[model samples]
Target chain A: MSLIDIQRISRLYQMGTETIHALRDVTLQIQRGEYLAIMGPSGSGKSTLMNILGCLDTPSGGKFVLNNSDVSVMDDNALSEIRNREIGFVFQSFNLLARSTALQNVELPMIYAGVPKSERHKRAMDALSAVGLADRVHHRPNELSGGQRQRVAVARALVNRPSILLADEPTGNLDSKTGVEILALFEELATKGNTIIVVTHEEEVAQHSRRIVRLRDGLVAADEILHKNGAAAPETPVFPPIHASAHAGPPPVPPGAH
Target chain B: MNLSELIENCGMALRAVATHKLRSMLTLLGVVIGVFSIIVVMTAIRVLQDSIETSLSQFGKDVLVIQRNPAISFGGPEVWEKIKRRKRLTPDLGELIREKASLVKSVGMQNGLFSGEVTSPYGKTEPSFSLLSLTPDGFPAKTLSIVSGRALNSSDEENGRLVCVIGSKTAEALFPNSSPLGETIKMDGISYLVIGVLESKGAMLDNSQDSVVIIPLSTGMNRYGRSPWGLTILVQARSQETYNDAMEEVRGILRTARKVPPGEADDFEIFTNDSLIEQFRSITFAVRVGAALISSIALITAGIGIMNIMLVSVTERTREIGIRRAIGAKKRNIMTQFITEAIFLCQVGGIVGIALGIAGGNAAAYFFNVPPVVPVDWAIIGFLVCAAVGVIFGTYPAYKAAQLDPVEALRYE
Candidate 1:
């Protein structure tokens, strides 16, 4: 079933005698358990679209239906509740509370959800383990490597077990190797049937998803299935082989190439 | 939020504050000072009031002193007029009040011989003391209990006997190691037998009851050769219920004896313990007003300091506030955190100030040989005042914190 439905959404910005359109007449939908990537260059409204989907910003004119509820009409407090219970967000900067240790950062979302302390601790530990940072839970952001902090952020995003995981350039601050490790974690989470949506400008990061939606000038430019080889796979496979022959040669022309 | 959750949040806030020790200490400074000032002033007033009450208690219930003029004058035009017009209340007025007034139990007339020096037989001591001449009924009327030997009887006064009652200090100085009762002491080259020794009444801030000698009024009048002096008549009412009526009756008798015209103010002053307390209260009321004015100025300054520091704290904690808001904290939550912190700071200050103030007030009372008093009400008042200051001054900062947009605050560097 479609978990997110955006109908004719638009976002306008007023900046001192001029009106700027950040997102214009955007409509899209994603089904449950789908791994999708939103790819765009700077100034293409991808961030604005991500913000709208995450319920951080209201659309100027449109309907946003999340799990059959019209979230666009929700008040600030209701929106916050939905954001806490239905959607988890990962920012490009890793946005881990700098003063808190990894376990404390992972406990943030559950804290907002008003979970009891013991239950919160148990769930947070489970999330940290899922993200492969169980041993580093006590380490603070400054004390950990860039990759570990991102994992902590990921753990925080998943602690409440929200319906959708929205990541904006989740590995943008890390080295290529560390970025690969984070992408692998995302792949692992998707295999567990959690829906994941990543917003990024890097094609390499976008290539990890089974489907890519490229946006330009506040509208979708391309929506196509990613092909591993010349033939179509039976299903969107989690952990698509990293050493597949598709990476050895020229990248296989994306499905619906023409 | 549930009560337990709210309590947990408070604990979190306290932990957050404890983590930044320097900041917490600096923030608490303003509260400490504010409370301290208020407590000190209140404690001092309490101590003074207690001492005054104690001293006033010694005057005995329903005992009134009728004199020629008011005991205390405020140096106004009315007082000057009263001073000029009042005639001396002579022995005749006392005799008439004793004989004619139905409410009168007894009346003792007294006249003071100031600056009288008494010397011991050993010639080792000579201290100046107020020599008071009293009638036989004076001791009982003034509630003076005979500590040793006996008080003067009618025979002593009638025969003009040279018997005297020496105060505790005078007995100590004259006899040293021996009993002063029945001992002869020379006062200004006149030998007098000590009939009794008065118990020590302790020194007041101004007057020492332990330093005076008492003799019969007639003896004083004859020996000192009356120079148109005023007499102090102590009138004991039959009971407290008729005390006021007795006082009015004595006033009427004195007015008749003095021949005061109708439609004119009486020249004599009639004072009771209640009137003396009222007089003391009026003076202290002025002092309290002055103290409140001065202390409030300081508290105002301290309040300003609190506001200034809280504003700085709000700015500094913008990021922390943003984090809290993003984590589901409402605007009221933010407001409560800061306001609670402000009140907490002031309460701490108030407690310290009250303690110090009490100590300071009692120290002063102690130095003056007066009993110390703790003003619990004033301490409570001081705390309430500090909390009020916190709410008043902390509002703007707390409002500013609550008004911060979560998005903007999160984005703030």
Candidate 2:
């Protein structure tokens, strides 16, 4: 059975006196360990789809089965529970609390999940180390480089060991070199048997995933297999030496793979 | 949520506020002013009430005075007209109460007269003092203790003797360092022997107790002559336990002596410590009502200010609320965080205002020569009122925060 099952889902919004159709009769399924990229231009409803998939929003009409549970009719509290225990979200802005250090920011999801302080601290440190940001745990968002902030956001998303990692334009604000580094991290997470869904408009960013689903005007325009090796496309050059230093080292290797 | 988790959430709320120092301080200003207004006014009223209580206590316990009119008048022209039409309480009524009342321990009548120049062998002072005439029992009835020499005896009043007890001021003015006993002082061109000098009793209602002379009641009636009324009778009850019984008996005796018909209201007025306190309380009731009404307006305005600022805070932290919600925080958690912030602001304000109010009240009391008293009840009420203001004014903002859509909130700038 697929990890995520969406059958005939639609989302509608009311703006002043007009009706806005954010999603229209979308049906899709995602299996475990799949690395998929959702591509669309601005106003193509890709972000709204991402919001629905992450359980932050509900469809106006549809059936959504996450981990074999029918979540379409679930109430807000149930959705929040699923979001905490099943789905982790990474935003484009690297939404780290400005006042908190990297470690504290990474520990936020565990706090909401009601994890004890000692365990939360330990798990958060481990997640940060997985993203190669362990040495910069004490640094606040303003004190870190762009790539480091994105790594912290990724660490926070994974701290709870969520079933799926959902990245919404995760590299939209980063430079090309930093974007490539983030893609490498996602590729490694997917190999560890965690389902990954990334949303973006840039083709180069989408090339890192094994599959690409393009959205247009609230519907899926195309779905195609992109790569099997989980490597960047040939057109994109290797990141320069100066930008490479910002990342701790070479890209992480996928877990359980030589 | 469990208690530990709730406490942890509260800690996060506090940290959020601490991170924004200037914003939190500005939000707290409304609560401070609201609490300050209530506490300051309450403290002032408490001090005034305390001073009045202390003044009344000085009159001693279980003492009653019978006069032609009440000591204080409440109504305007109508009450004064009724008082003017009533008959005066005579010395005969006092004598009847003294002779017949079972609950009465002692009774005396005093006739005040002879206000003029008093000349001693040492010097002559013009219009510097007044003379008072009293029956022998009046000394003990008024709680007057003689510091030196001898008080008047029954013989002095019965024989219309020309002996007198001098006040402390009068003794100082007439005899100076020399003893006032056996000295002669001239009042109204007549000489009298100074039989005693009274101990100093500080001013009562701003009237000097030392600047008077006491003479025999009969001598005052004959030599000074009566002035429309004979004397005002003072009665002392045996003890606090018998005070009510004493008052009832005195009322019955006075009514009979004055020849009032059955069912007719007595013409004489009876005053006691309880009655005087009642009169003061009525007057202060009006003052307190007026003060509370005025202060409440300020407090309400401050409450509105808190509401407005809390709404602004919710708007500014929209993204934070979204982030917390996405991470599994419930709507209740969001509500609690904002409400806690609002209440914390008000509590801090309450503490600051209480400190200032106590200091201000004690400073005023110091000027009046009374010991400083902190109105603890008012302080407690002030804190509760502040917390109430937080709950009342913070509700809408907290509700707005709780109603936020996680998706939209995350998109807010």
Candidate 3:
């Protein structure tokens, strides 16, 4: 069975006397280890769909089966539990706590999950290292560059080992070079058998994913298979050179610089 | 929540508070003042009460006083007039109690009239000291120790001798130097021999206790005539165990001696050191209730301030709440975080207030020449009340933050 199965889901919003349909009768299925991108313009209902898929919001109508559990009718508390265990969200704004270190931000989800301290710390360090931010673990969000902050948010999303790594406009706030580095990290994560669902407006970001689902006017416009399993991902710029511009000045040399 | 999670929430709350240092301090000021007001008053009252207790205890344990009026009375001129009209307890009442009350250890009659000069060849003192006229047992009954010379003996009273005992201050004023014993002092056209000097007792309620003189009751009556309303009877019980029995016996004798019928109440009043303390406590109890009410009003106002700040914090951190919610934090966790922050502020304020209150109170006590008191129970109540105020005021704002829709909050500016 698919990891997530959505059948004819709809989301409605009421503004004064008007009824606005954010999503209407949308059907989709996502298999495990799939890297899919949902792309649309603003108000095209992609955000609503992302919110529903991430279990942050429930659909107005239809079933949402995540890991074979029907989460569509779940209450807020149950949805929170499911979200914690099954989904990891990376927002467009790199929503890391401004006062906390990168490692602490990464450890936040596991803290809510009641992970043991030593294990949580170890996992958090591992996740930050995975995002190539091991040396920046002690730096707060304000002390980090935009790209580094995004990496901290990605590490936080990946720390819990959730079933799907969902990102909403993941590169929306980053420059092209930094955005490419984040895309490369996502590609690497996808290659390791992690399912990733990215919602963005940029076709360039969607091109790196294995599958592209396009949304328009609260409905799916097209679903295209861009690459098969074990296939080469669309060219995302390599890391070190891209990171040069991630920090505005000359690259901050590591403590043990040769 | 687990200990680590609670710690984590507390850490977050601390960070938030640290970021807005000025705002948090302002918010905490209200609580500090509220707590300070209460703790200071309570500490002062405790210290004063302790000092009063020690001073009153100088009248000796298990010693009762027979006077024309109660030791303490409340109300206006009407009540005072009635008390004033009661017949005096004369020296005969003391004799009757000594004769009839087997549990009585000793009985002495004294007059509270001390408006007279104490003169000597060396120096003369103004009429500012209290003079007591009593038999030999008066010193022991009033816990008045003899620092030097000898107290008046029964021979002095029986023979109507002009021997007198001087208080520490009076001796200092009358002799300045040299032993007062065997010295002659002329007063009211008569010469009296100094026999004893009382120990230096400290001030009571800011009144000088050391300035006093004592003479035999027989001599006082012979020289000055029987004081119509100034006679005071002192009775010492055999022991604390027989105190009530002694008092009952004295009452019965006085009633019979004064010709009060069986059905009628005694016109005079009977009291002890304990009764005086009890009356003082009752009066101060009203003051304590008033202080508590005023302090609670201030605390409630402070609580309202905390609630307002918390609400503002919730609004300012809407996006943060969204991020936390999306990352798997339950509403309860969010609520816990905000409430913990509010409670942290109040508790910090409470601790500082308590310290200040104790310090301020002790300062007042020092000025009043009383020992300081900790008032442990009031401190505990202050802590609990601060925590309670936090919870009472914090819940609504915390709930508001927790119940925010993650989707809407994420979009909030």
Candidate 4:
């Protein structure tokens, strides 16, 4: 089964007696280990779609199946659980706890997941090291630079080992060089078979992903798959590998396919 | 939540409080004043009440005194006039109750001359001593222990001997350099030999307990007539279990001796150590209620201040709350975080208030000549009240924070 399957989903907002249709009859499927970018302008319904996919908000109608669990009808608490276990979100701004150290910020999701203290500590350390921020674990958000702060946020998103790493405008606040560095980190994570979804209006940020899904007027405008190995793996991959963990998942893409 | 999670929340709460030092301190000051007001008054009351109980206990719990007026009266001057119009208890009433009341273990007569001066060859004290006269039984009933020599014997009262027992202060004044026992002292132009000196009794209700002189009943009656102040009959019961029975027997004997008809109230007042303590407790109970009510007003005002600050905190940290929610914190977690912060502030204030209140109240206790007391129960009450106030005032703001939409809150400028 696909990791995420959304069929004809719709989201409506009521503003002073006017009904605003943020999403209307949008359908999409994402297999495991697929690096996809969702692109749109403001009011293009991409933000609404990301909110639905991240389980921060439930769809007003239609079906959303994440890991075989129907999430469109789930309540707030259930959505939180799904968000903790299956989705990792990185915001445009590095949304770190201002008072907590980098390790504490990274351990936040597992805290809600009821992970034991010692284990949570170990996993948080590993997540920070994975993002090359091992030396900055004890530093607070204000003490870290803009790029380092975003790195801490990414470590926090990855600490729970969620299936999909979802980022919304992750490098919007960084300089071009720092943005390229973050995109390289995302590319590295995707190459290692970790499923990645990024929402950005910037084409350069979207080019790092293998697939692109564009939305306009609350509907899917285009869905395209780019070939990484010329005509060999086909332009569009009908199926993606499922296991994405660095240690215990499937073998790391046959070690040097290029 | 588990212990580890609680510790994490506490750490967060502490960090938040530390960051906003001035605001937190101002918030804490309100709670401190509220708790201090309550604990200080309560501590003073507890100490004063304890001292009164100890002093009253000197008149043994099983002992009763028969007098013309009640020890504590609530009915004002009109009742005092009526009681004064009734018959006075004479020395003969002691004899009458001793002879007729079966439950009475012993009966004695006592009288007091308000203030008098005592002079020795070397020194003389000011007119500050309460001159008392009593039979031998009066010593045990008053729990007056002698430090030296002997108390009055039966022959002293029967023969009207010129002998007396001086209190610790009186002994100090009259003898200064030597023992007052067997020394001759002059009072009211009369000479008397000091037979005994009482042990020190410190002070009670701003009065020095050691400044007293005790002589035999007959001697006092002969020297200072009983026209103005009549004798008080002292009756000791066999044991505490038969105290009520003993009181009834004395009441019956006194009624018959005073010639009161049946169905009429006794012409005299009968009091026991227990009754005096009870009367004191009733009066102080009212004071306690008043103190609690007044302190509660302060606490409510402080509680309102807490709610206001918490609301402001929630508004200020709106984006932070959204970030936490997006990071997988549920509504309950956000609520816990805010409530814990509120409780942390109150607990700190409550502790400081308890310390200051104890110090302040004990200072007041010293002025009242009562021993200082540490009110453990009041301390515990102060802590629990702080927690209750935290919860009561913190809920609305925390709830508002939890209900904020994460999408909008993160977008809040």
Decoy 2 TM-score against native: 0.72
| Ranking of all candidate structures by their TM-score, best first | 4, 3, 1, 2
B180-280: candidate 4 lDDT, tens digit per residue = 87889988788889999888765554245588888999889888885427677779998889999989888887787788999988778788777877787
> Can you list the residue pairs that collide in candidate 2?
none
Better of 1 and 4 by TM-score: 4
How close is every model to the real structure, measured as TM-score?
0.74, 0.72, 0.81, 0.85
Second chain TM-score for model 1? 0.82
Interface RMSD of each: 2.9, 1.7, 0.6, 1.2
Which candidate has the highest TM-score of all?
4
Classified by CAPRI criteria, candidate 3 counts as medium
Per residue, candidate 2 scores C-alpha lDDT tens digits across B213-254 of 889888888886555363678898999999988888888887
**What local lDDT score does residue B396 receive in model 4, on the 0 to 100 scale?**
91
Top candidate on DockQ is: 3
DockQ (0 to 1) for model 4: 0.48
lDDT of 1 by residue, A1-258 (tens): 378888778899898999877777677778778789998777778888987888767899988999998999988778777777888878777777666688877876676678988898899999889778888889989999998888888888888888899999988999999999999888878777888999999999998887887776676666767766532332533332222232232343343331
**True contacts recovered per prediction:** 0.09, 0.47, 0.75, 0.51
lDDT of 1 at B137: 82
- In order of lDDT, best first, we have 3, 4, 2, 1
Whole-model Cα lDDT of every candidate shown, in order: 0.76, 0.79, 0.85, 0.84
Q: How well does candidate 3 score on lDDT at residue A35?
A: 87
- Candidate 2's C-alpha runs over 4 A off are A14-21, A99-111, A115-140, A191-193, A221-258, B1-33, B58-96, B107-242, B254-275
Which pairs of residues collide in model 3?
none
